[model samples]
Target: MRSRLLFYWISSLLVSGCTRSGSPPALSFSGGLVVAQIVTDSLQLVDPTRQRRIPLVRYFPQPGRGSAHKLKVALLNHAYHGKNTDYKFLADNLVAHGYYVISIQHELPGDEPIAMTENLYQARYPNWERGVQTIRFVLQELAQRQPQLDWQHVLLMGHSNGGDMVMLLAQEHPELRQVQQLISFDNRRVPFPRRPYPRVLSLRSIDQFADAGVLPTPAEQTQFGIELVQLPTTIHNDMWDGATEAQKQQMNAAVSHFIEKK
Candidate 1:
């Protein structure tokens, strides 16, 4: 009789504990547009700066009652078939912290590789230009879709080739000059922008075999006023999706601090 009573008591306790296990947090909003198809046909060739149709993914904070100031963030993925899901953790955390993240899917199916030639810039110019135009289209859409967002708090972040693209955008787009913060994850092709412009935070990963290119040297960082954070045992791809939870959280904290910094 006592054994039967004890078993029932334990089972009840187990059920009670199971019921208290936390439910998953709500997911953020994700959506985008294909610029070329969405825009009017008259705006096609007539527009001097044109690009192939591209998709943009917006990961917005879950709807709630709060007073946190919202910022718009643009996250560009790496080159050659890279998808925006690569930066899922980064985007989700940013959303949780009151920022709207726009992930640009710059590469389309059947697109040719970025050409190589005598001029280094010429080799990658087309690819980078396409990314910039995609971002511009999304920004125009956001102006209408999210008027309450604080445009002054814009942040641009990218990984690998996407990181190179962000640097190129900073260099070529005068309209983006007002963009306040830039973050790159293991991009090697382009150097950081000129000194005293938008502040920069570069997260570098070390993998001897990859030859991921030169990040700003410490002296360069000091001269250009950029911040460089190195991950000693990290690999290139792991900097994005493959990163461990601890690694992701470390990056999230660093990014949050930089964004919140005055």
Candidate 2:
């Protein structure tokens, strides 16, 4: 009889602990996790410079991090055949770390598709140039809309073909002087320009190889402080939404840490 009473009392304690003051347990996201706003605008912006209507996916912290002051900006470009939202994982991480992320859809409906070329660097010139113009216009558009954002410090990230565009833009017109960090995910063709202001990072996939000179030499990397991380078991295609939980965690953590540096 005594034993039964003790067992029942323990069970009751467990039930009460699981329920909070007779209320159902609250749904919890991990502590210090910033919930970001997704698809706030859902609009296709017209870029007169490119004469193309560009679609973009924007993410920002719900209440916004450092809204009183100017928050940083992140411009994410997508891989070839990939949509603007494919890199949500990285965009969300950026927002959590106090950045306003804008993922650009470089390829639009009825646009000329990127294709294989005899010489990738020379052939993709127009595509990359068009992308640069799109980025320039987007920055101008955002300035008009959200002038409070910190235009001095920006982060540029992209995957595959989009990564190529990121590199090209960083090296070309306007010189992206505001860019504090430049990251490319498995961009195989474009040569990473040697620069000092915007620290460079190249996340290489295990399955694909960058064309010769696309990557920096070890000595040059040391000089410029370029960070190159090779993902284990992660292929080029998996850099997007197709990534496994482990891959996503690894990539997200790496990016978060890099951007976290002051």
Tens-digit lDDT string for candidate 1 (1-262): 0000000111110000001134343333222211111110111111234646655656653344334455555454654557765766776566655566777777777877876557656687788777776666666666666688877667888887788778877877756765778888777777677666788887766562212234555566678778776655467778776777667766665666566666
* Per-residue lDDT over 1-262 for candidate 2, one digit per residue giving the tens place of the 0 to 100 score: 0000000111111000111123222211223433423323345799765468988877765443223545579999998888997876676566656677888988877877665858767888888888878888888888888887888888889898888988888777445677778889989888888866688887877788888877888777778878787777689889997787668777776675566666
Kindly give the stretch of ten consecutive residues in candidate 1 with the minimal lDDT sum: 1-10
What's the distance in Å from true for residue 216, model 1?
3.5
lDDT of each: 0.60, 0.71
The collision pairs in model 2 are none
TM-score per model over all chains: 0.73, 0.83
Off by over 4 Å in 2: 1-40, 64-67
Cα miss at 223, model 2 (Å)? 0.3
